[model samples]
Target: LPTSSSSEDFHESSSSESSDGTSGTPTLEPVPSPVPEPLCWEM
Candidate 1:
């Protein structure tokens, strides 16, 4: 479950204040993400 910590960190960063959470959803599959921004967030 520790691997999920990486996803948690994304939520803590720019998306922490993200109200809709819709934007954050794509982070779940950042492996095939089209946007560099979301890919960056995944890391």
Candidate 2:
């Protein structure tokens, strides 16, 4: 579900970028990575 939400957000940003066609090499920030919890050592 979180991944879907992030993808939806990305789509929205691209649509906005379309409006400014001549921005000349628009730079985008890196997407935030999800941090995984540490696995149990004694599992």
Model 1 residue 11 lDDT score: 64
lDDT of 1 by residue, 1-43 (tens): 7779988887677567554667666654563556777768899
lDDT of each: 0.67, 0.54
State every prediction's TM-score relative to the real structure.
0.27, 0.33
**Per-residue lDDT of 1-43 in model 2, one digit per residue for the tens?**
9999999998868756754774423333222222222233334
Candidate 1, residue 22: CA error in Å?
A: 18
> What's model 2's overall lDDT?
0.54
Model 1 ranges off by over 4 Å = 15-43
